[model samples]
Target: MPGRVQGKVAVITGGASGIGRATGFLFGEHGAIVVIADIDKEAAIETAKEINSLGALAIGVGLDVTKESDIKDVFESAAKEFGTISILVNSAGLNPRLPSLAGKTSEEIWDKVIDVNLKGTYLACKNVVDIMAKGGGGSIINLSSIMGMVGYNSVMSNGLSPYNPSKAGVLLLTKNLAVALAPKNIRVNCLNPGFVETPFTETLTSDAELYDNLVKLHPIGRFARPEEIAYCALFLASDESSFVTGAPLLVDGGYTAQ
Candidate 1:
């Protein structure tokens, strides 16, 4: 039998590593023509090659979601290569831990995080809406965080953290887009994951004490694996979620329940 998303096309940003990479692999396994779009061109290519090696149709495209030109080019290329886009996973993001944010003014950090995490999502969705609508509708999975729903603990951050608000923006964006596009049959939703063990969290997880503290926050007693999050994305992307839209599906191991 064919896979759940057989013959569909999926474009994933930040597809070079972590949750995005894992999602790319899963999407490919499910028979989607996967497009790995990332700023890390080489890694994206390698990921696409790996997917192809697994006997799946896949391609890699360089994308900087913060740039409109790059976003447009990625969709255009995917459309030209694989036809209409059926799924979009906006997984590209940045956190305050990025070395570039060190010593930067609060305004600078806020702008940077919001640009990549929030605005980038908006841009990708804006660019793909037409393609998906024209193709008879599709699914859009945005990556939000538990922080988007609740305030960060003091252990995570003392005052307002830019990452928190940026993710919150993503959740709202997902909702707004979902509502607007529901009439067109396009489903827009977001995944609010707890702390996940990804390259993006290496800085914090690398610190043994911090890692332990982080784990304690999640009632599940551990941080999530990338594949764990990928599975959630898979459900949202597949037809199994045909009735789900504008929802902030929490895969946070009960972190927000407390």
Candidate 2:
């Protein structure tokens, strides 16, 4: 169990915080050489250092997933250092409530969310395919959301937020890549997590009224911990899930089931 991903190299975008950071720690604990890539350079480095202090091998790199060059550099550098890029966790994403979107036009908000959530995942997968094929196979774990499988409650959303659509796009992208890369032995899958207590959901979770309402949506009556989702990503990353591909594994606390 300790070395489930032994000797594999995993590059996780948005590894500075939230689900990404949790996944990084979990993968490292399982013996993967972790590459923490985040738009926040300082935070990424700090996370890497923390992981290293925990006796795991990790390197932090600044990455803006929206930039093709950044993705190229991270993949190339990781490959050069570790010799093979085996796991990719596309955790870099943006939601409508991101603080940076304050005062931005609706169009701008949509564009940014889509670019980071949907397009960023695409770029990472696109750049890593060849590398993985050369290494004889790998796993790609995309972070979709419950919204991808179901519409937002009309009371909470006007049905125009790009967040839902972007996640939905990830589902299809994962499937397409799974089929296309099947021959290469590369496995592609996604995780549709329900509301987890992460910075990404800060706006809603921090609101007492809103938080209670959201929790009620999940039959479990509570949100997930970051490690819960990380464990699912670990299963997909490890050979234990070799036969699973193009699957959207929902860690939604029965949110979608309802």
Q: TM-score for model 2?
A: 0.99
Backbone clashes in model 1, listed as residue pairs:
none
> All models: lDDT?
0.93, 0.95
Query: Could you give candidate 2's per-residue lDDT for residues 1-258 as a string of tens digits?
Result: 559999899999999999999999999999999999999999999999999999999999999999999999999999998998999999998898889899999999999999999999999999999999999999999999989989998756887899999999999999999999999999999999999999989999889998999999999999999999999999999999999999999999999886
Model 1 is weakest, by summed lDDT over 10 consecutive residues, at 152-161
TM-score for every candidate vs. truth?
Answer: 0.98, 0.99
Candidate 1 lDDT, 166-204, residue by residue in tens: 989999999999999999999999999999999999999
What TM-score does candidate 1 reach?
A: 0.98
